[model samples]
Target: MALRESPESPTPRRPVSPAPVELASPAPTRHGTAALVSAAAGVLLAVLWSFEFVDSVIGDTVANNLLGHDAKATAIGGTGAGLLFAFVSGFAGTFTACNIAMVASVGPLSQAGASNRLRHHLRSLLRPVGWLALGMVAVSATYGAVGVLIGDGLPQLSTDTVGGMPVRLIQSSVVFGVIGLVLALLGLSALGLVPDVFARRPVARVVLIGALIGGFLIGRPYPLFNKLFHWAVETGNPVYGAAAFTLQSLGNIVIVTLLFVVVVLVTRGGFLRWMTDPARSALVTGTLLVALGVFTVVYWDLRVPSIFGVGWFPTMPYN
Candidate 1:
């Protein structure tokens, strides 16, 4: 016999519906991506500028080597010569391995944005670039003062007989070779051709990288810079040393700004998107750097002309 249904009879209930899966939002648009990249680029630039500026103060080697004139002599020759030397050295330094790497690294950062009209794109870059410049100047001044203190406190080394000409030439060649190797590795990494260990970009550790570059400049004393430093130290005027280096740094700033502006303008046209591509940009940058390194070694180190006398690389007239 069927049992009578109880008031609270157990009954099969309808199946419970499964919870809906939530979807992630779509990836950021190119414009949004560009904006984010630009912001990051600005921060990177600020950090690099700050560190390099300090390094400039600490070393001043590149300035002295490239200028090939005593700061005092220039000052006596006329403020014009001093200023010109400062500007020339600063501008020329931008082409060095570390500096060129800095420039190439920015390409990926700038590529994220939408292609605006050339005028508008440049306008957008101006503010960030201006901030970068200001950061450099501010940091340079602070560090320049510190450099002066260090210069005054340290026992001066005699430049007159530091080494024979042959020894110095060999030393310079070895230094350039090492720098060329470093640049070559950097270029390969930028191209993504190297192992992941070496391919790390500049975004996260830019400060550290900049510091390393600065340290390198400081530790390696070239003949010209050594001579200049000796002259400044003998005078017993830290101001002269500080001013000379500071002016040189300012010269670098001017060229760097101009170059950056040109990059922004050229890239804005979108004709060079390959330059901004994560992989491709690396390739191009790496190629250029490798070429630069090779050229430095062959031309500057060997003191040889390019094939067919083409003058593919620049050689310092003073050298």
Candidate 2:
């Protein structure tokens, strides 16, 4: 009986199911990398426009039309008229080379928190703008007081030329170069390529940006600002100069405010919510900072130097 059990009892094995194959969806497009690339594209656009023809086309035509060429500052000269002129001129010249970059400021305001309640929502929208003005007023007003007190003594306001290059332009090169570098770094910070100083320090970053925009006057070569400056000096009232410059900076930011209003209205208050998304916020902020930063540097440092034979950059046929 024991010997009978040996015949056909082969070992039975359980069927092994193949491990589930994971079909990984393609990786999502990285917002950070995309943002960085966008910044580079913006710089390329600016570089392409570095030719003299861009001056003829965009600068002369669009900027001149907006800035109202031949409208003398002296013509706009009463006490009220002068201040009015300063503001209006600033508003008109928003598209000018020195100031257009300021549009990038909207990027920082994107950090503002959103509210569903209408009254609170509007306040939230405007709060950042006010913070920006705090820093702007400090710089613009202080510079105005100092600028008028000095009255053409600053090398930036000088009318002389060296090696066929305007001395004021040289000053422009230096000032803009530094600011441009700062802006580029800010962009990197936004993209998290650099230390994310701005993440925990929103107010400070905004204030810094506001200060930079306010400082634009320090390097301005605009004919209107020059005229206003001379008129300010003629009056010999630093208070008047400070008031005028402060109004000017206010006018510049007014356009930004209006654009914000339009955007919020158009999006039905959705843009603010859109900005809450970390990836989108980083994309927007990083792109703008890098673009304008690089433009400021390349235009003032490279393009301008090339104009006076200091170095060479590519020029278009129309240029």
**Maximum-lDDT candidate:** 2
What TM-score does prediction 1 earn?
0.47
Candidate 2 residue-wise lDDT, 1-319, digit = tens:
3664446777668999999999744322454565557667756655566333333444345434654654452355576867876786677557666776787788788675444444566777778788788888899899888988998798767889999999988988888888888887888788777688778777687888889889888877767677677777778899988999998888778888889878977887788778877767777887888888888888788888888998986666545
lDDT measured at residue 282 in model 2 versus the true structure, 0 to 100 = 77
Task: Note the residue pairs that clash in candidate 1.
Answer: 34-112, 34-113, 190-282, 191-282
Please report how far candidate 1 places residue 35 from its true position, in Å: 32
Q: What is the per-residue lDDT of model 1 for residues 1-319, given as tens digits with 9 covering 90 to 100?
A: 9898797999879999999998754322432343334334433332233323433543345555656754323442444554465455555555442344334324323332223344566555554444444444444444444555566343223223223333333444465556556655555455444553434433322232232233223323333334444444444455655565555455544554566567667766463344444555544445544454444445334442221242453333222
The per-residue C-alpha lDDT of model 1 at residue 194 equals 55
